[model samples]
Target chain A: MQIVLAILVGGAFGFVLDRIGATNPNVITGMLTLRRLRLMKTILLAIGTGSILMFGGQMLGLVEVGHMSVKAAYIGVFIGGLLLGAGWAASGFCPGTGVCAAATGRRDALFFIAGGLLGAAAYMATYPAWKASGLLADIAGGKVTLGTVPGSAYAGIWAVSGDLLGIVLGLVFVLVAFVLPEGIGGGHVQEMPAE
Target chain B: MTLDWKLGGILLGAVFFAAVLLVKPIGVSTQFVILDGIVADAVSPDFITQTDEGWTSTNAYMAKSSGKYAASAAGPLNYGFVFVLAMAVGAFLSSMLRGGVPLAERRAPEIWRANFGDTPWRRYAVAFAGGFVVLYGARLAGGCTSGHMMSGMMQTALSGYIFAAGAFLAAVPTAMLIYKEG
Candidate 1:
């Protein structure tokens, strides 16, 4: 039952991603370069809508907060994020979008997926050394949320409940998404280089 | 008709919310780890067993401890694996319905040509390198854009925000540097 649900949901997700033009490397790189603002608006809107529904569901006790998993914070995460960012800028495909692109029959995206698999295999091969390097060590209360807010929890800097704050921020995101100009990059469909 | 970006984005959010309600958080990277495990297992029967040093093997860790690990130690047949496969199928179906197969006649775009030139080898090389670095970094960071930035931030997790800041801080400058020509 769960597997079926996963496939359905994942399929829907992929369909949406493709429809938004996220499967296009040009669109992705354009967003990274601040030339195309449409994808950014789409991303922000998705995040905002998800945040509102998620937190709102939590407030209503319809959603289980425990079901939401939080990633751990460490110096490694930030540094790794920087690396991922650079990669995204260069390749214009993150893990998810890479898969989507490949599905759309882009041969380059297949190569990208192959590279990512090899990379993941390399990470597994060297896992012991990296784990012992202390770079992956958790810090600043790993898995922290706004409720914890690092050092500010006791000071009440984020006095509002995390869910409420999330809703407020989500609304702000929705507002920004609406206000952002479309066709900033002229919505030009650049022809892909012949394979 | 093609869905507009806003409606598509909202629909994505709705699907994500429903998925989270039904199962667990949505992510894509762990599927790669599961694939790695399956490949390793195919090469060796003892691929999943623990070593004498008490260190967890990749398969073991993926099966037992990874955040988005499968429901069982089923390797390639696991839930996460199936979900990712389904995602591909979905994309393919969408493309098919929209027209024919959405194969790219040209791989790179004008900006890429202006910056990186039209060498196929260079483009492929950079893409491979980029994929490797991104996955490696995502593993180290415990999440990728989808897992950390999207789901984590939706829940107001500080790590998500921090990761987003790092991603943008690096991505913007890198993009500018590489594609410097206006």
Candidate 2:
């Protein structure tokens, strides 16, 4: 039933990642430094395409709004983002990519996965303590489900209309990928540390 | 036609099909369970705790994990963990089929050598530390790379946009530095 369809869908996603070298950390790392455009291009494409499908589906009533979880927490997000970003710069693979890379038998990816698990586990284990201590006890939303963080007016566009917003962002993502081939290529980006 | 898109459609399409054919959907929060199981076994006291009502715990387990499972993020049996595992399995199976396995790079550059130890153990340790910091941050941020960026943006999540900026800003530099050393 639904589960069956899910498996098929998942397999395809993984297949694409593998074929595109999404499972390769070298690609991710390269893309970040602006050396490789391959992996970034794939990511941009996924985002652009995914957004369009979601918007169109919702607009057509093909799916429920509830399916798209919109809840957001900025404080947790900000700190966590900083940490994850630094990690990516260091390790090259995000959580999902790292796991996939590990499966591909990449030694570094395995290490990344192992580290990811530990980090995630630690966060959860300490959540209760952090909550009780009031360290993160009062951290609340600076924005709503749609979220709001200054410096990005493009979001105001999204807020005006989900459908319009979806189309615009989706198109923009693709446009960026297309215009800056080097910025978002596949597994062979041009990045590397400046010696 | 974008080569990445065509390949993305076909490859991810395959992942999509395989997911439907195998077990459940793909996700990372779901992997919390496997992580829980492993960390629990690896570290004593296991985070999961059994109660009169059942188990009450954190993101993954002590077998006491709660909050959300696969079917939904709010309930039990969180299948999100399963998706992460499936991602791993699928990738593993594919590489195996291709006859290509993990290979260590012994020719790391001098810059990299300075930043990281020349040994595998040291390199893995640094990576582990990096993973730990990132995942810990991801949860605090209310999501991981997937949650805040891909899934978040798909939902038109403002948080996702902000998260993406932060991610790229930091990640891009790191990649460049490493690539240089390598």
Candidate 3:
């Protein structure tokens, strides 16, 4: 029963995202360049709604507080994020949307999946070499998430959250998507007329 | 840009969740089935273990508990792997039903053509490099932002915030350069 509800909810989410034109690079780029805040607004709204539900779920004792996994490797995280960003721009699809594109049977997406899988395998294959080589020896096992936040060790782990960062990025993207227009978004989505 | 956001947002959230529950959970990480395939092809073919792990029983039963004494079951392929497969199937099915125009072959955008054509492997390289980076970070910090930021923050984990910030700082320059031309 619970699983069924989950499916019903997920399908609806996928459909709306596709329709929002979130699947389009133009919209994503628009958010980054500030030529259009459409994507930004959509993302913010998603985040906001998610936040409320999470908090509420916790207060109601419906969700587990400790079961959430927190395994992170700085280099991998940084590179993964950086790579994902570039891949999105270069390929016009991020991990999430890429899957969406693939489902639509976009030939390009099929290749992206192929490339992505190759990448994953490559990592696993190298795991032995990398681990033996001391790539991960420097870092200790997982620590509390907030411990990485600067000057916040005394403030508590929750303070480690980069909400400020998310907001800043969101705002920057929203602004760029709105103000820059041509240089950022299209330089001219319409191409001017007359004199 | 002009669509009704309230309705749109609700609908999308549902799509994401439904796909996960119905077919597989959604995770880009799982598309590595290609990796599984290649590994199966080149490696010893026994690289992935067949040993009895915890969820194998559930999978066996789900696989129809086929036969009287099968001794084991495949269950739902690794959690991540299943999600990845479902995502592709879901995306493809939805795109067609929605009447999205097929991406043109000849008229493929310069970005699309240049990126994939001049150097096909570069895509693989970038992906490899990116996965190396993301997974590394995920392991180091204790969790990817999805587990931390999205799931954690929602649950109010302090660490979630930390990971989220790091993810953004990392994503900035990459997004800028990649999308610079546009």
Candidate 4:
């Protein structure tokens, strides 16, 4: 039953990702370089909306805090994130988007998938070294949240309510998405006359 | 035809929200590791073995979590792995339904072409390199964009915000450097 739900949910997730032009490398880079804000806006809006719904649902008791999974905090996580960002900017594809793109018959995505598998294998080979490096050691109390979430095991860095903070931040994201221009400076998108 | 950007964004949020509400957060990169384990196990019987307790792997990473990963690797039909495959299938279905990805989209993107060239191999190389870097970094971080940034942020995890900041700090500079024309 869970596996079946995974397929249905994963399918819907991929469908939306493709429909929003995320399957296109150009669209991704365009957003990264600030050449195209449409996709960026869409991404921000999606994140914001999802945040609102999720946090709101939690507040209303419709969502289970126990189901919320919090990743452990470590120095490697931040450094790894920076590396991931560089790759994202350069390749214009993240794991999920790359898979979606490959499915769309973008031949390049196949290579990306191969590379990702290799990368994963490489990490597996070096897992012990990384574990010994202390970079994986917990920091900021390991699994902590920005604000206190009732019924969750995580500690709050701040005493504020996490649900409220999420909703507020989500609203800010949506607002920014709506206000952001399509392009900046003399990019191609900016060359078009305003509506 | 593709959905409108605004509508698409809303729908994307809805899907993510539903998944989190119903079961668990959406994530993908970890499955890549699982795939690697599965392949390794298949090629070498000794790579993963069934213990009295459960499954165990010669590889320590897979052996962690009480051989939970090894179990998934041995079985290979779990929720997370299948979800990733389903994502690809969904993308294919959507593309076909839209009468196939336009030729321009199926190949190098405009920004890429403008910055680099139309050579397919070059683009493929870059794509592969990028994928490699991202996956490696994701493993180090213990999560990817979906797991750490998107879902983590939704859960208000401090690590999620930290990861997000680090990602953009590196990404913006990298993008600026690579696509000087754009």
Writing each residue's lDDT as its tens digit, candidate 4 over A1-195 gives: 988988999999888888888887777777777777787777778888988999899999999877788999999999999989999998888899999999988888888889999998999899999999999999989999888877888898888998898899889878988999977654552211122
Question: What is the DockQ score of candidate 2, to 2 decimals?
Answer: 0.39
**Interface C-alpha RMSD after superposing true interface residues, each candidate, one decimal:** 2.6, 5.2, 6.6, 2.6
Docking class of 2: acceptable
Error of 2 at A122 (Å): 2.0
Which candidate tops DockQ? 4
For candidate 3 chain A, the 10 contiguous residues with the lowest summed lDDT are A186-195
lDDT of 4 by residue, B46-144 (tens): 998999999999999889889988998998889899989999988888877777765654676666767776877898899899999999999999899
Supply the DockQ value of model 4: 0.65
* Candidate order, TM-score descending: 4, 1, 2, 3
lDDT of each: 0.74, 0.57, 0.42, 0.85
Predicted candidate 2 versus true structure: per-residue lDDT over A83-133, tens digit per residue: 788897777667777777776766766777777777877876677665565
* Fraction of native Cα contacts reproduced by each candidate: 0.67, 0.48, 0.19, 0.78
Q: After superposition, how far is residue B3 of candidate 4 from its true place, in Å?
A: 3.7
Query: Model 2: what TM-score?
Result: 0.76
Candidate 1 on A98-168: residue-level lDDT in tens? 89878887666777788888888777767677678887776766767776322222211255677778788
Q: Which CAPRI tier for candidate 3?
A: incorrect
Weakest ten-residue segment in model 1 chain A by summed lDDT: A148-157
Model 4: residue B161 alpha-carbon error in angstroms: 1.1
Residue B115 of model 4 has an lDDT of 74
DockQ of 1: 0.57
Candidate 3: where are CA atoms >4 Å away?
A1-10, A63-75, A129-195, B1-26, B31-43, B52-80, B105-149, B156-182
Q: Choose the strongest candidate by TM-score.
A: 4
Per-residue lDDT for B1-182 in model 1, tens only? 34676887798778768777877777888777777766776687566654343324444345445423423334356556777888888887877676633333336545666666766677778888888988887776778888888887776777888889888899978876777643
Error of 4 at B93 (Å): 1.7
